[model samples]
Target chain A: MRFGSIIKVALRALLRNTMRSILTALGIIIGVGAVIAMVSIGNGAKAQVEAQVASLGQNVITVFSGSMSSGGMRGGWGSAPTLTIEDAEAIEREVTGIVGVSPEVRDRNQVLANGLNWNTSVNGESPDYPDIRSWKIASGAMFSDQDVRSVAKVCVIGKTVADQLFANGDPVGQTLRIRNIPFKILGVLDSKGFNLFGQDQDDAVLVPYTSHMKRLSRRTNISSILIQAASADVIDKVQKDITEVLTQRRKGREPDFTVRNQVELAQTATATTQTMTLLLAAIASVSLLVGGIGIMNIMLVSVTERTREIGIRLAIGAHGSDVLMQFLIEATILSSLGGVIGILLGIGSSQLVSHLNGWPVLVSTASVVIAFVFSAAVGMFFGFYPARKAAQLDPIDALRYE
Target chain B: MPPVVKIEEIHKIYESGEVPVHAVRGVTLEIERGDFVALMGASGSGKSTLMNLLGCLDRPTRGRYLLDGIDVSQLDRNALADIRNQKLGFVFQGFNLLARTTALENVELPMLYGARKFTTKQIRERAMHCLDIVGLSQRFDHFPSQLSGGQQQRVAIARALVNEPQVLLADEPTGNLDTRTSAEVMGVFQKLNDEGITIVMVTHELDIAHFCKRNLILRDGVLVRDESVSNRSFAATELEKLSSAEAAAKLTGAKS
Candidate 1:
């Protein structure tokens, strides 16, 4: 029997009952659609998280100052200010692959400038703060090491701070008062989008750690330390060396800090979303199975309904394999058709979601192909039994079937 | 010029529940090329069973049956199907034209399943020619449902002849038609027979059997009678006389 002719016959049979064919394929359509939508949305969320992690800088490592369990007291991360300038300086000198280090001290303060007042975070850092954070200076310059050593009253302003304090003027060479203490503006930092924690990173002030420790919100210990490795290849070695140096600095005392790398952070951030995508895909796959079952059900009913037709074909000299091929091809075409429509539905719904909810969505070609091939496979898998049953039917019995 | 069909002591036994029922017992027959034969019997006489055996739809349990001298009685299912495709044509009582399919496509079905591949144009041309032979060329595109009963049976005949089989086996070809339509269908069969196409028909009606050149009677799984038909009915004359009778009745009814 000719393959093309068999397919043509199957198509003709399906067209005979167009409404039933469409209804039978609906299960596969919805199933593939759900899977595509969920995968796109989940991948979009993951990509956003990875981008945020990357924004923290390439080959970057940070030592967070809490996770301390000492003397019947448990302190969570960022709660205890155990890290200090001395520890940051020690790691900078001891670690060989490090290119830059910044002692970080964070506090919230209200500042007044040009008769306007706004409340924002105050960050204290070294001259290498911009490089370690991948933050660029929009104008003017960063505070120099001389400024740090001399405890000069100078600070750089984030874009939000610059916009707020000097709406009509350049922020450089302006004086902003923190706790009524006047500080000269050195430069304006470029805009950085919100971070993984949903904090507006651009809404803050930058100052020398020395000046912050001595003059404003004076505190003893620094909040954390940020370090930049020379390259991605040396990140793990640099991270290991920093952990050893910090652990040695404690001198057998309970370790009060956690060492983390941006790569690790990115993995941790995207893990949940990847798993969610798989979970949604798995749930969607269940619907595909249901869709396959639907195909099998309809095919079985069709086989019974067309028993006399099968009889006629067999009587007219069609081989059993020909009858089998006819029905199987019909099933595969129905499912593949559904798969295509589902992919379109998925892309459209994902796009609609992204447009309406502002959630990032990534629809890859690989997933579309997989969904299509999978639905086709499902159709064949479910189509085989009924097709075989039709093929094995006795022509005499089938001819007499009412 | 071997005989188209020759069966020697063909026997068919069916294992129905417990007691083995012998459907055809020691039946021997020969049908030559271009011959028209009618196998006739009452219900339960196994004539249908013998017809099935000749069509190769079922294999006989014991015998040497040669279809166009091919010795097909012991062949497997697939081989038998191939033989049926290449050498035999079948028409059923129900005018088994595939419903919803146009007459042309219906006729093209057998060619699609044949052992030799045919180009689409070739298949279409052959099917159209067969339909033309059946005098249904104008109705080639009409579906079976759209055609009248006689027309549908004619389409079935076209389908049967599309493959140009050695023998055409029709099981009650005009069973579903009225008397005039039966005569009309029989006339088509006669016309085809005159063109040297062999035909075998199964019928219980004596008048229907008289249309064939030979009559075969099976009684209780046995061939009790086989005789060359005398004064065999010619469908064309019978149809003409019926039409004249109808015209006369119409005149009388109008006068009344």
Candidate 2:
């Protein structure tokens, strides 16, 4: 018989048992839906992480102080003694690829402004800190180099601090109490949202390093050094240059600080997100496999149920291949329908999840297409054995079936 | 004259447990073109087995069978299927119509499967013509469940005739119908035979067998008798006489 006629016959037969057909398709629907939804969630999380990392300045590098031990007892919780303001200045002077550098000292303290009080951490750094870390002054102006040189009692507040303390009023050119000492608010930093560690980058305060050390904390040494390359591609060269410069400046003290590149940080975050996505997708694929088995089981039953019909067709004139094609087409149609429905359901579920939880959920077209194609392939692979059995039946015996 | 169907020393054995049951033992038969023949047998006489072999549905265990000078016994499964499509049409006692399909589509099925060059339009036209021959032209769109038992059998007959095969094989075609419906279906068979279509039917009813021109009786997997039914009685004429007598009795009762 013609292939078109066989397909039509198969479709008609399937339509005859509408409930059974829909039930069979449900397996595929769940399988494909789970795959798409899980992968989209994973992709969305990865994108959110990437966006946070990008906000920290993709071209910037951070070097944190290692632990210091004296008399076999760890020193007090302070900046590493080996690093200093001089080291930061020397790196700035000697490093060839470095565009800017900032020596940082951080401390958590309570601040009061306009009778509203909020506890927040403060970063003590050079005038180059804002540019190197990609922070922009949203209002007013940044503290100048003269402020660091003169130990000026001036600071910049982040948006979160401004929102809590100032409350819709401009805090620039105003004074806020830091550790019960008066400090003038020089500017407000733009919002930076949250980082991968879930810390709000926009909730802190910034001050000149000399003033913070001499006036507030009474400390002299620095904690970490922040540097920015000209672009993302120059980060490696910039790292090597800084390492060499710091080594020479510390009199070759075997590099007492840890320099972390943006590439490594990005890669670590990406690996973690990718592993999560893959694990989720693998678990969902188990359902797809189960769906395949479901199809096989149902097809076997269908072949047995239609044995008499098959026999009659064969007795009339249908070839074995014709019978095989008919059953296979039936299976393909069932799976394809299931796949389409599953895709729609998955997208809908993802959107619903995002809406309910207020979390980012991204759906990729490639993943949807892959899931659908895989479902169809699963149908063919699972439907083959039953179709073969149907095709190989003896016409006489089949006709005699009760 | 070339025979439409020829069987020579055909043997069919069925394996039952440890013993082999002989279904057909050295049965030989010849059926000429355009001859309406009947095979008469009681239950378990192996007449169905012989019909299965003649229809090319089963291979003979031994001996040669030829249909239109082609040795079907030696042919493979696919070749046998081709022969059935091109040369033979079958009608079963149960009126095996696809329950979901219309009468016209059912009749078009064989033509669709056979190696013919006819277009879909031509196939439908031929199917309608065959339904007309069986007096079911108006019921072409009706499903099998919508038709009576005799009408379904007539539809089966139309399906068998749509392919214009060399032989028509019917296994107890009127076995499921009442006396009146059976006579109506037999009338269709008589009319088709008069148009020079060869038919071979299996029947246990003597009255139904009398409708054919020849009869072959089987017992214990062998042909016991083969006779010409040139002067057998027909049930239709006998029923006509009975109905006329009833009508006359009704008139006499009214006069009294």
lDDT of 2 at A399: 86
Residue-wise C-alpha lDDT for candidate 2, range A263-318, written one tens digit per residue:
78888998899999999999998998888888888899999999988888889988
Write the residue-wise lDDT of candidate 1 on A200-293 in tens digits.
9989999999999989868888878899999999999999999899999999988888888989888888998899899999999899999999
- Model 1: docking quality category: medium
DockQ of 1: 0.77
Give the worst 10-residue stretch by lDDT in candidate 1 chain B: B247-256
TM-score of chain B of each: 0.96, 0.92
Go through the candidates in order and give the C-alpha RMSD of each one to the true structure.
2.8, 2.8
Provide the TM-score for each candidate, comma-separated.
0.93, 0.94
- Give model 2's TM-score versus the native structure: 0.94
Model 1, global lDDT: 0.91
Per-model C-alpha lDDT, please?
0.91, 0.88
In model 1 chain A, where is the ten-residue run with the lowest total lDDT? A66-75
- Assess each model's interface with DockQ, reporting 2 decimals per model: 0.77, 0.70
Q: Write the per-residue lDDT of candidate 1 for residues B127-151, one digit (tens) a residue.
A: 9999999899999999998999999
| DockQ of candidate 2 (2 decimals) | 0.70
